[model samples]
Each structure stands twice: as C-alpha cells, then as structure tokens.
Target: MRAIILSGAGRYADPWHPYAETSARLAELVAAAGYDVEVRDDVDAALAALRDDVDLVVVNAGDPDGPVPDGVEADAQVEVDDTALAAAMDRGIGVLAMHASASSLRDYPAFDHAIGARWEPEVSWHPPFGEARVHLVGTHAVCEGLDDFTVEDERYANLRLLEVIEPIAEHEEGGVRHPLVWAREFGRSRLVYDALGHDARSYDSAGHRALLARALEWLSHVPAPTADDRRGAAGPTSAT
Candidate 1:
C-alpha cells in the first residue's frame, strides 16, 4: 500500500516552526507497517500526488494560527484547498484525521463528509492536560488488537461525533463521556478519527499506536502479513 502524509502547515511563515518532525514520525510508523510512505508540506502538491498512487491520505492539518498561504483562503476553520481534499475522498481514497484536524475543516461539507463528523468547540474541550481512560466500545477492525487503555494527556470534550461510528475508545472525565477514537465507513473506503496525539507522550502511547496501526491496516484493506511474508521481503520493522 502507498500512503501520503500532509504536514508542516506552519511552514508557510516559519520553516523552523513546522511540525515536520511529528509528521515524519507518523510517516515512519506507517512505513514500518509495511507501506511506502511519503511526507510533503505543500498541500496542493500533496493532493496532486494523490491522483493515483496513493491508497490512503493522513492529513495532520496543524494548528490554525499562522496566516493562510498564497492561493489558499481561510474559510471558517477550513482552508480553501479543502474542497480539493473532498474531491480526493470522493474518489474512494481512505482518509484519516489526527489531533486538531477535527477543527481544521470546520464548515466545509466535503470535510464533514470525509470526517464523518463535525466538531464544536463549545462541547469539546478536554482538560488542558490530564489523564483519561479510553474504553473500547466496538469490535471493528480499527479496534483490533486493542482493549481499554489509559493515556495521560489533554482530554478533548464536546465533540459532535458522527451518527455512524464504531467507537473504539471513549473518554470519561468527571463522569462525562466523550469519544476518543472511532471508525466509520465512507463511500467505498474506511475512515478513522482519533482525538488523541495532542502531545508527544500521547503519540508514543502504546495503546494509541496500536489503534493507529489497526486503523491503517483497516484503511489500506491489507491484512497484516504473516512472518513468512517477511522472508527476503522488505518488511516493516516492529513499531511496538
């Protein structure tokens, strides 16, 4: 399977401030999962490159702080190129959203369609920094190999999850419930969204890694190859 990771959104203004490292780590994880992965910061180029070779697109639409780049309009919380992204999704490519990505495509219909949910800031503020246990609520492939787990990090609250969801992880804080990870099918592809990965520790969390691995495997429609497939083949290194 081939994958493309779109990161470094902050680079249009400050190259050093780009989250390229985080995105690179994500690409490494995907590559280690036995897929060819490429990382790019240019949104247009990323979309253009997805014309045929890409099977999955992992967009880390970073924080919406810097000014929108040339030829890209900032509409609500979504960038103008989001329409093109929707066009790509419409073509049946698997899409995955990470961290603050839920807030990136705020009012775009295609983004909503691709994400399978809409996020509202009023309802989705988790403690700025804390620990929350994630409860698995389904048996979908995205939740495969993972059970209930806990991670200490920022807990997001007040997210309006899509109606069609096989929740893999639910966050409970102060007796209130919120979704942390979930999977849903869109068109002919699978889409998974996880509200984790706000910090380095969250990304490094074992449970979160497992969830992401399973999600990638599910989205690519490629089962994990057996040990024998690794013999004389360029297999992915262990990510665990």
Candidate 2:
C-alpha cells in the first residue's frame, strides 16, 4: 500500500507541538507495515501525487494560525481544497484524520461528507490534556485483544458529526463520556480517526501506540475485509 501524510501547522497540535515528532513515528510505522510512505506539508502536492494506486491519505494538519499558503484556498484558517480532497475520496482512497484534523475542514461541508465529522470549535470543546482512560468500543480488529487503556492526551468533546460513524473507543472527562476513536465509511473506502495523539508524550503511551498501530491496519483494510463486519453491529460488543 501507498500512503501520504499531510501535516505542518502551528495549531495542528496547538499548545502541545507534537505533530513533528509523532508524525515521524507514524511514518516509521507506516514503513514497517511495508507501505511506500511519503510525508508532505503541501496539500496541493499531495493532491497531485495521489493516484488510484495510493491506498491512504493521512491529514495530520489543521486550520493554520497565519495566512493560508498561496495556491491554496482559505477564508482565514477554516479552509481546505475540498474539490481535490473530495475527488480523491470519491475514487476510493482511505483517510486517517488525526487529532486537530477534525477542525481542519470546518468550513467545508463537502469535506465533511467524506470525513464524517467536523470540529466546530465554537461549540465543541475538550478539557485540558491529562491522563485519561480510553475504553475500546468493541472487539473490532482495531482493538482486537486490547483492554481499557489510558493515554495522556486531550479528551475531545462535543464534536459536530455530519454522519454517524462507528465509535471505536471513548473516554470520560468531568463525569461526561466522549468518543475518542471512530471510523467512517465514505463511498468505496473507509476512514479512521483517533483522538489519542495530542502530543509526543501521548504518543509515548503504550496503549496509544497499540491503538495507533492497529488503526493503520484498520484503515488499510477497507471495504470490510472480513466476514466479521463490525459496521453492522448495533452497539459496541464486549471489550476484550
């Protein structure tokens, strides 16, 4: 499989600054999985490079703090090249939007159609980053034999989900539980979102690494790879 990681923004991992370091580890993991991986900060270059052969597109960047780059469209930071991105998704490319990415395309409804959710900062909120226990939703391969795990990361709360995505895991903050990991179906492909990696320290968490690794496996295995399609489950099964 081939994958492209789009990252680089002052706010992608805002106030934490983990994208650079953690993204390196992510690339390593992708390489270890035998995928031809390339990392780029230019979304336009990514769109140009993407082809039918490419299996995955990882959006690790979010709304920029300063002016959006030239050749790229932006009405402030709430901007993304939706036409290019949506076209790729329409052609069956898998997507993995990590951390701040949900807030990346907040202004583009077309982008939301593929990503399944949007981060409307005005309404959505998360508490300070801390050690939070994350509960896997079910026995999906993404968390196959894993048990309840904790990670030192931001507990994302109150997201705007345009479509109903399968909740893979969740966490409780201030007595209120919130979904932390999720998967969505877009056209012929699939996308997985993991809210665990807030910074380098969070990535260092053992359970976080396990989930991230499994997430790659899950994202790559698109269109329901096996007979046990977790998408059809009415609710989360027993956690392993």
Each model's lDDT comes to 0.67, 0.71
How do the predictions measure up, each by TM-score? 0.76, 0.80
lDDT of 1 by residue, 181-221 (tens): 77876655567887777656776678877878888878776
Runs in model 2 lying further than 4 Å from the true structure? 10-16, 65-84, 107-110, 223-240
Candidate achieving the largest TM-score: 2
> Distance from true position, residue 123, model 2, in Å?
1.7
lDDT of 2 at 2: 89
Q: RMSD for each model, in Å, please?
A: 9.6, 6.8
